[model samples]
Target: MLVSIDRRCIKLLQELEKETEFVSIKSLSESLDQTRRQTQYDIYKINSLFEFDKLPPIEAKQHKGVRLMDVHREWLKDLLDQENKKEDSEYNYVLTQEERCAVIICENVLRNGFSTLDDLSEQLMVSKNTIFIDMKIVREKLKEYNIECEFISGKGYLINGEELEKRKVFMYYISSIYGLISDGMLDYLQDEDVKRHIEVLHKIEEELEVHYNKGIIEKLALMLHFSETGENTKWNFPQKTGSALVCVNIDHVCRSHVYGIIDKYMKDRSDDEKAYICIHLLAGRMNKEYYLYNETEEIFEELAEKLVGYFETLVGVTMDKRGSLIEDLTQHLSRSSYRYIYGINDGSELETIIRREAEELFNVVRKVADRFSHDIQCPIDDQEVAYLAVHFSSHMHRTSAKKYRYSSMLICDESEKKRENLKKRIEDNIPLIQIHEVLTKAEYTEAEKNKYEVVISTEVLDINDGYVLISKKFDNTDHINILNEVLQSRADEVSSLSDDLFDQIKPYIQKKQVGTVRSIVDHFFGSDQNSTLTQLLTRERVKCLGDKDVSLSWRDAVFQAAYPLLADGSINRHYIDSIILNVELYGAYFYFDNGVYLTHAKDTSGVFRSGVSVMTIPRGINFPHNKKIYILFVLASVDEKEHFGVLKEILKVCDSKEKTEWLLEAQNEDVLYKNLRMIAEKK
Candidate 1:
């Protein structure tokens, strides 16, 4: 009988086998980063498995620690070696719930015959019950692509959907889940056929001066190989009515390379099949420059303008680098729109990170992206929204007055795509440090280390030059470390300059005035703290008008919300009129879905300073279309950037259901202000 053991037990067994003599329990625990008790428990489990297999168990002595006998050590080594080999094979590797679901979908869609529950259970190394549950999840995922997973009693399971839709899901699963076409996936294709397909793709790339991501290359190869192996009959092509750019490019490719190459291998392939290949190529192309000189450039340019215009109106700030922003957005939309329309996921690894780090910008872009979705007649998902957020964030950083104090270099071994992504993340988060160059380990030189103030490497360096080592997955800790380094470098430079300036003027000043001169120098070089939401929306600015004796109209509620700001002279009466006029023209565009009306006008003609006022009415005020507003926030700003911090905080409150509910439940101004302060502090 084989007994099950956790990974810790396996690791402990390996450690014991490696020791030539007895090792102390403390040493063993330290090696594994666990308590002595936990290590003992793991040893017990390992011994149980060894006893079941009739092998020599680990020998532990009270004075020393633990060791494995030669016989048991050899057996354990073999067992571990086998496990390692299994792990190296994708088919034998364990899958997460999501990965299992994706594998099931891929198998059902790509396999020639129906797969039974037993087949899936054995393949995934899970129980039949787990496979059954996974199938249900697989069905729901397939439903998103308008596909269905069907089962017949004795026939097993199969997916039924439009051929193109099924292909889309299959391509997505193969590209995203498996990450590449594995050996198991290529079981049906001959090595020669696979090589031929790759050669054709390479020829196309060379002719077009464009490259696809490795994963995309594999996906296209699989598609081509399958098409040659009699899958072409089921392949259906969608109407080619959109941009002729891809088609024109494909025409050139076919004339130059594809026709000559296909004649020798896949001569029977139809034009429809070739068209399908072109569609995938268009969606998967890595470089944006390919779309720059296309005939559809003007159309994408117009769409980019509308997107930026919509974003500006929503965020209330004129973006810097308007021409560059439009051009970059056009390039992105030209390709990304196809991915959305064809249901191809670009597999952005930064989407979740970007969404979390730039929540305020993501929310604003998500709202603006609705216009793009409408234009393409396809819903833009969070991955695409995250990409848009990066663009806007880079724009925001450029337009800000914050200076980049430290020049930096990034040493990353990732692909060009990933290097650019890391560079963007660093720029977006730590604007004070500008990455001057990205180099691989081979390209990096010791002489270049002294050129940059800050050197960040994804991998550890042999020489210790005080370079900051960060993980490939750049997290908040790495962000803070880089930021601190940049700020410190700036401080050091400023301090040196200030000391020299003060010394030069010291002889001309009196002894009593010396302190004042040093203070002036320090103040001149010191950084100023930007205004925050908590500073603007103080206790005096918050109000809880619960269960009013008389109902108030929307116009009256707007006045009531702005009363605090007006009373404090933060705004004039005309500011109130501007807010009402904005509502009348834009039809409550400021009203959020979380029962909070954040009313603000772009016109700051009647504003004196930046201020925020919050008010909650339990007896909701009547607005147009009988919409009741429970919580209202009025913002008055002298300029765009001054109120931005406060708006971000307000947007965060509006984004959360729990935070909005807590504010709504507050019965008095004190409670509301306390809750608001808590939220701001948490951020």
Candidate 2:
């Protein structure tokens, strides 16, 4: 039997397998978005369980990080696979206060009993104040579903609501929290009727020509089981109450097939149960299959058009006409609506991958999808959003559109040196435009005014040609405005309106791909491929400070560590805050062993540029959960691939106890830099 473990431990185990090098507390904390202290506590809990179960202990690598010390990695993996094969209910989870409250309240209401705050507090092993807060949150949550949590003075508190709504809330909450099957709930499916019901479902699917997402059939079967079991309990459905639910329009043949199946196990209760199960069937269908119903065809068309429009706006290019991107999106939305309406789960696994690849488009799609969900009263999950992104991304790669390039000349009536400086400033600010020449006042000629695409002059010229007036200063808003005007006009040059949208999205989304404005524009326009990894890993971005004996608070240390990047304008305050936020939420996942903390925000929200900052402390700073860090390496990167080479170099330097110790004992910044260079060179 597998040892009982909480979700955190399970996550730790999963994360451990992915670690190429020794896993750090800071890395785990950031990835898990838990505090370092909480992460350490979880690690301790998991390690203790491992000890109790006589499993190989997770070995600490001194200053590096933690490692799965089992000699046979494959054997350890097989052991984990064995544990996963066990029933989900057999695994125990360390529930949060809210989850505990939900369980307690759900059981109490299902039993048609009242429980005082004091009773709940004692039972859940929390203070009465905590129970009070839990109840308040529960009450607020139930209100959204039109369920009421009534408090009777002498009777304590009991839930008063319609049976169907109560059961909906109950099943939704339970399934969502405990995963697909709960302990008692699993027994319902274990019975013989489950097989027959599945057969009926399969027949219905065959007739409808629609398939369901995996496990959805079981979920629907469980609903029927719940309806039958709840019949014996106080939960009762009113005949009129069924009308409030949007009825799924099953064809006559499919309806009869479903009714025939339900009649075998639930003869008298078939009417209500069949309707309830049909709602679930509708929710889980993976295809649009709108030809079966005329009314839905129009609805799906509208949804598809809206989704396509939103995607176009997001990716900034018209989709290729050859594909069924709209039809595909429509089908996904059709199925996704059920997930939203019924509160079914769509996971974030794919979203993470898509986010890393094309984050700007992901954010746009998410925002647009959210708006659509609001209109339709269905909440869009990131998983569904990611699926949409996949379709849009495919469209993006297969098609091409015309991009604008501006060519202009600067006519500055200033000295040679001043004109040169002004030209560089304009080039830095508006790199998309090619400045043909910088003409001084003495060199000015009316005949050469129209030679370039646009003319930018410091003094107002009385010419009808394309002339933009600007100040003699380096950074002038008038020049920027004139350039923006020119760029905006170039939008019409493209075949699709989305090309304009792409231009609009560039400033917002191109932070990661930027070397300079010209490079960014060229990269976007398909003239240049992406930058090389070596070019991205430049030494100008690397910063280091050494101290054999210095100490600071964890928060202060992180702020101080990030200060160099912040001061240099490589990262904004938001980036620093994001790093701190990750630590606070995820615990010390970034805190590698050996007194080094790898701190960074998971996303590029606050990054002005991709850069790395390093701070060394001999005495070390104290993080939560007894984590002492000697070195702090804060990274701010726009791209996911930013740290690959850096991490490789760092891992080599900190691979062994001897190497990490020697590095820590380095006398000066020059020595540290030399050792770091040597290690990086070896790689």
Candidate 3:
């Protein structure tokens, strides 16, 4: 594909603005000598480039007239500076011009084989600042040809690095920092050795201007080598790494997936970084092993210290002193396994296990470590640490947010044979969980304040408001049935709470409500069928499907279910899930956002099949708007099937397309797409 020159045109316009700050369309048109429309066309072109590339957008306050915002004034100045430099170069074609002067001098210095930056600056009659900026442009342009301008502290810049070797290094460097997140860099700390490391990085950075501009840490990773280049880019390796093997198993099942990271880390970066990051991601799913490497033990230990230090800061506690915190990682992992004892027979039936190993795999410096939360996770009864999502931080500040369950409460009845055995089972299954408490009804109160928002009860009990009743009995009903029931029950509680809360604040809402809403509600409540209609309206979307008019496949079911509710205006919070799922089943496309799907349903792929929506996709997986519609299916029980709209309702609540898409894709049928591994027992 050919690249449009919008960025260049924007650059030109910005420079024109700077030179003539009070310039009109007439002046701008005269500068380009084009039509007034063409001058405006340039501004539009500028916006498109900035919008697409995500460079700060050009903000114009006035709609009709040309204007420059306060924020853009600096950029305008820079633009004019560039234009002046260009004009100076064109008129004064000899290399004496300011912009060309430094490069010409550098070429002279390189031809002489050696000259310090001071000498070059003196020779060029410009400040070191101007010289450096000129060299900055030089280096940016040089890397395209696989050339690197080597630098020394006292010495000036020189592209004298061996051509072949430099090209390889440049490629490596580019791949490393392409999307490199800056973190883990030691600062000027209390320790001398740590300072040494930062100093080493600093000195190397000066010589590696291109790499600093890019990220050198990313280059160090070996896994993402071939991601940026086209598939035919002559660099190839064995298809899968050992870490890839490990991620394959639980990547889908894990609460937070690294697949997108893996994909992005694979394509837009270098092989080393890709592979290294993948290894880290795999270690993230420690104890729940699919692939194990020789260095798993060492790697797991390092990651632990990093996590501990991070949590200590987040939770306002000093967790552990950070040097190379590798020796006592086993102790740091709150507890190694979890056995969720279902209380139906007091949690014995759902005595399932979840394990988290690799507790102390991350190594951190104390100051850097002190900035994080060490209490990121811990396991409890019936609760398993499903995932450990890590985020990068710069120095000691949290550059990103991570979701780590600190402690999961596993509620069970106390009639088991032995407490020791149950405790052991829990420790073995849930590695990241600490022995917070083995709670029965009495113990449940003790463990009420936990990390999970809901207090998971083995059986339905009148506990606190936030207590959740998890089905301790894991009988093989249907996967969709399980999720649909759980989600709907939760939504119902939330809806009830919302209504009660609204009633409390009705006076305020009535005062604040715009005329349109007041008029509509008053009109409806005044009707004859107001009582019957109120019940239906309060329940949100009420379906009155008289009878099946035509034969329909599972593909068309969701849309069929939704069309009537939408028309009737009964499609409220409650009806969205059924509508989405019906559409997903019939149209073969799952419409969803994180547990919410209804609002995002309308943008359906008439030909929808496989898709994953994320706020940010690592591999850039986008919905194929023109692809054939896909039909989502599930082997659900009658109750779950009937209540299929429950999922759609959840999607609408989440209001996140990615979440809806993930759950929908996760809940898709194997008989239809042949990818039932997400939520199915394979025959």
Candidate 4:
């Protein structure tokens, strides 16, 4: 069984990932044809012996649904890939002509960490004597560049060329290898669906993976799979190797007819008259809206510009700053939305319930959105963040890799010197490098794709379908990574994946998930308390993504929201949670002032006090929606003179709009349920 689920299987999984709460014992057993007992044992070993992951809250219960830890479907893929890669391969078996060239490139890189030999030589082959004419042809190719090929004594052979020419040589080398691998991938994934997906994933790679920012790339890819098939896949190879994401205009997606259904009954419950595009999301209501943009880029850009315009309109009232305002808001949304999401205890039961038909999920989203919007008495779509995903996908990849720490030994002596000076000055100003690094080349390669930092190079760049150049600069010294910046860049060689809505986000957020929320927050918000909250918001937003067939469980939202609050920058303190979760068994019913004053505080303990920013955490994955619990807190009160005793009851209400209005009308102590002190002191 172990062998059956061996390296190849793992590698396959790495290539194809999905969104799933946890690695299933039954799935693994059936896929690998092992006993469930053995599967369980392997999971145990993975947890206890291998320590692959911390085994996130294996027994922790979701407030309402079945709870289970979500493992990146790609994990299975990567683990399998790693295992397969670990298997032995002869460094030099019967040499294929192409593999020989790659070997030569590696050898040169080992020697100088760079290379400049261009011609494909046959001298390393055992049948070199029979291929004398091919060798002559190779020699002729080298002569065009003033390079020379000669046989050496003990070492196979050496190609003599200046170090300055290394960029071209390396470009050709990677291109050759990429062509082979890309073709191989096409063949390996012969299944029609798999091939289509791979194609889409390739476009995502072109758009988002970027200059090896592994985390974002991985998450984006995993999420893409999750979006399409409702499966979570943990993949490592593409991320580790490099990938990209195509940007998507979420608003355009939301407004499209395919996004949601036209149910006349939904009208009474809905908040908007505008056309509604629900996509795979569950937007509860009967509404309509017009949408534009045939592709992700056009749509994302349109939405971003519109969203930005709306923000601009709100400038005097909402915010004052102009520069990087969108980025700042993006960070804000990323942090503020997590309070509503959580992990489940038994994922299977929850999956069974939430494992909806596409239409069902879509309807549920509409219902949830309509209901929630009604409860809040505000259009959720009005917030700056409501359209965040749409705009975020728009310009995220417009900038490319900055050229850093990379110097090409070249023939243009003075230009090269100028480039060097530019590098130094830029480095002095933006010294955060030694990471987010790129080896971009400014020189062109006949091989069609050039992959080197162009920031320091003076070489003339040509724009083709794949010839991406990171042209945007913050100054002479600051620039985006070229790999992701040039969205339509043609590369003789680059990570290729299919482009879809999920594919775009997948490439951007894939690997970034593990600790991404914190890192991105720290970068934007730093030690500020709001940073933690901001990441929660982004998590909140992410939780709401995907096909509505699987509604955003309040369970996940609740955990995402509060889990971040417990964080204090340091990993240690962040894990310690002091809060508790509770929901009414019969549902959170409204009680007028005339209702019973509870004899016991514990009975009312599960009830949130009014005026607090109430956050509802999800129960187990399969738990019913109403059973989800919340952390209620008092946010605002009517007259400042309201007593503390009355305040406690105000925070308990789960509904925000109602909570607000209730506080507004209160006139006497009767409106105030028992205060915190009374509840604590009571029997």
Tens-digit lDDT track for model 3 on 311-389?
Answer: 3332222332334233333333322211110000111111111111111112112222322212221112111221221
Which RMSD values do the candidates have, in order? 13.8, 20.4, 28.5, 28.7
As a whole number from 0 to 100, the lDDT of residue 426 in candidate 1 is 76
Q: Candidate 2 regions off by >4 Å?
A: 1-45, 48-56, 59-93, 101-127, 158-168, 180-247, 250-254, 268-270, 279-331, 342-567, 570-683
Rank all candidate structures by their lDDT, best first, as comma-separated numbers: 1, 2, 3, 4
Query: How are the candidates ranked when ordered by TM-score, highest leading?
Result: 1, 2, 3, 4
The better-scoring model by lDDT among 1 and 3 is 1
Residue-level lDDT of model 1, residues 1-683, one tens digit each, is 23344445666777776779999987887676554545765776677767777776788787787888888877766766766455442112345576677667766774556789998888777999999998878876677656777888998887777665666666656554533134232242346876777877777767657656445566677656543234255444343445322222344434434345444444566654554566555554324432323444577788889889877766666787788778777776765665665445544444545553456777778888865565644446666787777666656632222343468899999999999999986765544457899999889998888888789989878756447888898764576566446545655676777788899999999999999998888766553223377778878899888575337778988998899999999999998998888778665665665678888877788889888999988767767744567889998876666667677778866664556887888988899999887766551
For residue 485, give model 1's deviation from the true position in Å.
12
* lDDT winner: 1
> Where does the lowest 10-residue lDDT sum fall in candidate 1?
179-188
Tens digits of per-residue lDDT for model 4 on 1-683?
Answer: 12122222333233224423334444545454434433443443333312334334232223221123335343454544553565532211234444454445433421322122222233343454534444444454444434566655444445665432222233333333432334342122334544454454444345433232212222222222212111122111111111111212335544554334422222322222111112212221112232121333333233333344433221101222333445433343232221111000111111111111111222222223333432222222211122232222222222122121322221122444554554543343222221222223533353423343222323445543322232223231113232222222222112222122234555567574835543444443221122121111222121111233235454343344333333322112212121212222312222122221111111222222212222322221222332322222212222222222232233222123333344333332233222222222221
lDDT for each candidate structure: 0.68, 0.58, 0.35, 0.30
List residue ranges in candidate 1 displaced over 4 A.
1-295, 397-449, 452-531, 548-551, 619-628
Model 3 residue runs over 4 Å out of place are: 1-127, 130-299, 318-497, 504-683
Each model's TM-score, in the order given? 0.51, 0.41, 0.23, 0.20
lDDT tens digits, residue span 427-471, model 2: 544434567888865677887776766788897777664677887
| Candidate that beats the other on TM-score, 1 or 3, i.e. the better one | 1
